[model samples]
Target: MKSTPSNQPEQSVQKTFTNLINALEQNNYTNFISQGNPAFKEGLTKQIFTHVSEQLAPRLKKGYSSVFLTKLNQQGYQVYLWKLSFKDGSDDIVARLSLKDAKVAGFWLN
Candidate 1:
């Protein structure tokens, strides 16, 4: 299904991780980089963001934004919003890595 960002989590973290692992188990990791157009890649990245955000945000108190993504450079990984909130009035973040090797990575939300 096409992924749409929202203000909440769609499932649990364990479930998101399991789905990612299952997807990897079923396909080669390098294929996402080598086999798709930019739009397709973006779509995949959004899906990952949605899944991770849905799984992690509920454990925190502040509101998390549904969309956040930027490619830092040609090689550096793009940052996608898995979760974004306030902790002590500072940005708290949980995100997924969109490098050819997809994985979860946490960072300061700001």
Candidate 2:
């Protein structure tokens, strides 16, 4: 089940999200994890990063816009969700970003 919270995150989170998205688009593993927490960085190695990047390359290359959806709080972490709409007629992607202590705990796209 999805938790459709009433509010979206603040502007700061939007900036962080943009940075993360840019890193992904550039396929820079180091920059991608630059804002991540130790655990988050440890969980993703270069091989894993390459695989995911390969899978997302097509969508990432195209112009897209993201709409803030809602935020969820879990175990002292803030999890924000966004919907990405592609200009090339690809399917939308659901982006989830979790932050703990002002650092990225994890990020996923589905």
Candidate 3:
């Protein structure tokens, strides 16, 4: 879906998150980090990505499902909450996006 001006930021952030997950699943770290903000890009490395992926491997074994839970806007940042469901359990994923610039400033899978 295309985003209109009114809801462009939210839509863009959502799309970014979707694409990031797809890239990660495909082991395409370059494409994944390309969607990040400057700081995110600077801080994330291949080793870090590998470590994080390994840590989440158990929950991702059967693959997973996701649902958009909510969004909170504060201090120019839009924090999107997503619920990730695995075969064994569930967890929360947080994406702190900078809507003002349409970039992902931070992300967490817990």
Candidate 4:
């Protein structure tokens, strides 16, 4: 499906989040980073990517169960939050993502 500005912000953010998850699952950090904002790309290097991948590998193994939490608009950016459940008994993952210009401007998986 083609995505346009008229699409719901939640739908757009969800699609982007799904794609990011797929890239992470496949160990395609390059593809994953390419989707981020310029500053995100600059902040994440190969070493950092490797570290993050290692840290997330275990929880990601069991995949995730997600519940939409909320949405907010801050400084012209659209932010979406999701509560993620993992099998490893870790704290629930709170995924906070900010979207700008149809791309991911920021992302946090806590």
**Each model's lDDT:** 0.41, 0.89, 0.69, 0.77
- The total of clashing pairs for model 4 equals 0
By TM-score, the best candidate is 2
Q: Candidate 3, residue 69: CA error in Å?
A: 1.0
Over the stretch 1-110, how does candidate 2's per-residue lDDT look in tens digits? 88555666788899889988888788889999999999999998988887888777668787888999988899999999999999888899999999999999999999
The residue ranges of model 1 lying beyond 4 angstroms of the native Cα positions read 1-63, 74-83, 86-91, 94-96, 101-110
**Candidate 1 total steric clashes:** 2
For candidate 1, write residues 34-102 as lDDT tens digits. 333455455556456455445444434343233334334335543334444444455555545333334
The Cα error of candidate 4 at residue 51, in Å, is: 0.9
TM-scores, all candidates, are 0.25, 0.88, 0.73, 0.81
lDDT of 3 at 91: 57
Model 4 over residues 28-82: C-alpha lDDT tens digits?
A: 7887787788988887787877777777766778767877777788999988888
Kindly list the per-residue Cα lDDT of model 3 for residues 17-96, writing each as its tens digit: 77777766666778878878788889888888877766665666667877776677888877777767777766545434
Displacement of the residue 27 alpha carbon in candidate 3, Å: 2.4
Clashes in model 3: which pairs? none
**Number of clashes found in candidate 2:** 0
Model 4, C-alpha of 17: deviation from truth (Å): 0.3
Inter-residue clash pairs, candidate 1: 9-54, 10-54
Q: What local lDDT does model 3 show for residue 48?
A: 85
